[model samples]
Each structure stands twice: as C-alpha cells, then as structure tokens.
Target: MAAVLLTGTGVTWTYVASGGHRFDVADAPDAPVAVVFGAETKTPYLTGRLETTIALVKAGKVRSVLVSGNAAGSSGNETRAMTSYLLTHGVPMAEVVVDPYGVDTYDTCARAVQVYGLRRALLVTQPYHLPRAVSLCRSLGMDADGVNAQCACGGVNLFVNEAREWFATVLALKNAIWHRAPGVASLPH
Candidate 1:
C-alpha cells in the first residue's frame, strides 16, 4: 500500500513537473489556438476557461479558440454551451472551432493533434488541471503551453478535484505512453 501510494504521488509530481510552466493571462505566449477543455456547463470551471480563452483571443495571443467538450446530445451540450458563451462574449464566430467529442483530457489532446492538426496550442483550464492538460497535449506531439483560468471555486468541489488529480495524472502518464488514437472522429467546426 505504501509503495502504491508513493508511486502514485511520484507519478503525479513528475507528470505535472513535465508540463514546464503555467502562465497567467497577461504573460501567456502566442499560440495558434487556445484549447478550452470541457467542464460542466454553467459552472465556474467552464466559465473561467471560456473567459480565459476570450481574453487570449482579445489580446491577440491566439489566432483562434477551439472549444472541446462532450456534446453527447442536444440537452446539456458542453460544446454548444461553450461556443455560445464565446460568441456572446465578443469572440467572433469565424474564429471559434468546436470539437464536440472531446469527452476527456486525453481525447481532447489526441483530437487536437490527430484531427485538428494543431502543432501548438495554449491550454486554458483551472490551476488544478492545467499541468495535466499541458503535459498530455505535449506528449501527443503538440507544443502546448498552459494558462491558468481564474475562478471563484472552493470547498468540497475544489478539494475533490485536487485529490482526483493524483489518480488522473497517473492515467495521463499511461495514455501518454500508449499513444492511442482517440475513439471518435473529428467534429471540428
């Protein structure tokens, strides 16, 4: 048990450390696109990510925004909600790309490379998630940098997400090693 726990911790730390840097909006480097990972629609997680993508676009740090998420169906579609949010918040429709089958971090990164042909991207997510996201994208052959999205998030939910990242990081390492293609096809807009 001790070995297992320590291994998980080690993997998490190395995985995150491998991500290199996490930038703030003001200091983020230019990239071809800002890839916003999906979260529950209407929540602080989703809102913060979308807002950061908007900022990146407005600042001309990225030429486009790629909103990737699980849009499994018409009801509660994350891709639709994310696209709508960006369009309403001053990001022009022409500059927004949508990937409705992102479903998870690995899939999102895989699709970003395999489907969208992205050589570089700015990953936008919350602090707790940015490292894994950046690492996954980089491992999949994209030159990925990350920008942490600000959010008024806390309490049980934040705690849960932080704790969950330990396990998620391990999975990320495995996925990176395997280099499997994503299950779904490109649903880019």
Candidate 2:
C-alpha cells in the first residue's frame, strides 16, 4: 500500500512538473484562446475563472475564451452560467465559445484539442488545479500554459479541493498515458 501510494504520488508530481511554469495573468504568454474549466455556478470558483479570463483578454494575452463545462451536471448548466458570467463581466459574446460536453478536467482538455481545434491555449483555473489542467492539455498535443485564478475559498472547502488533487493527479496521469478520449459524445463541429 505504501509503495503504491508513493508511486502514485511520484507519478502525479512528475505530471505536474512536466507542465513547466505556471504564470500569473500579467506574465502569461499570448495564446489564441483562454480555456476556462467549469466550476459551480455563482461560486467564487466560477467567478475567479471568468475574472482571470477577462484579465487575459484585456491584457491581450488571448483573443477568445472557450468556456467548457457539463450542461447536464449537478452544477446546473455550467457552460451557460460561465458564458453569462463572462459576457456580463465585459468579455464580448463574439469572443466566447462554449463546449457543453466538458464533463471533467480530462474531457475539457480533450475537447479543447479534438473539437475546438486548439493548437495552443491558456488554461484558467484555480491555483490547485492549474498544474493538472496544464499537464492534461499538453498531453493532448496542445501547447498549454496556465494562469492561476484567484478564489476566496478557504476552510473545509479549500481543504477538500486540495486533498482531492492528489487523487485527481493520479487519474490525470492515467488519462494522459492511455490517451483516453472524453467519456461524453462530442457534438459535431
């Protein structure tokens, strides 16, 4: 058990390290799109991601935003909510692309490459999630960089998310190694 845990942790760390450097909004390189991963609607998680995306656009770091999320999930139409938030916060509607089948981190990364035809992207998510997002997207053959979105979350919620990343990282490595396609059927472009 100990060996398994240690090996998993090491593999996860390797994936995270393979992502290279994560940047803040100010230092992020120029990219064609900013891919905002989904979070619960109306939460700081969603807000921070949209806000960071807006910052990237405003700074001329990215030209468009791809909001990816599960429309049928418990988050209650995350793509819709994410699109609305971005638009209302001054991100132009013309610059927004929605992927409703982004049911998870791997799905989002996969769809970004397969469906959206993204060659490069700036991934926007909270700090804890940025590495995995970067690693997964890179594994899918996209030139992926990340910018940390600021969230006001703390206490038990933050603790749970941080803890979840360890297991999530292992899953990310598996997905990358096996070249797993997204579980959901993608809409035809």
Regions of candidate 1 where Cα sits further than 4 Å from its true position: 6-19, 73-75, 185-189
Q: Give the lowest summed-lDDT range of ten residues in model 1.
A: 10-19
Question: What TM-score, over all chains together, does every model reach?
Answer: 0.90, 0.91
Candidate 2 at residue 27, lDDT?
A: 84
- lDDT by residue (tens digit), candidate 1, 1-189: 975785476456645555556899999999999999999888898999998888899899999999999887433689999999999999889998999889899999999999999998999999888888888888888988999998989999999998887678777777888988787744435
Best by TM-score: 2
Off by over 4 Å in 2: 2-19, 185-189
Cα-based lDDT for every prediction: 0.86, 0.86
Q: How well does model 2 score by local distance difference test?
A: 0.86
Looking at model 2, residue 22 earns an lDDT score of 87
lDDT of 2 by residue, 17-96 (tens): 65565899888889999999998888898899988898899899999999999888765889999998888889889999
RMSD of each: 2.8, 2.7
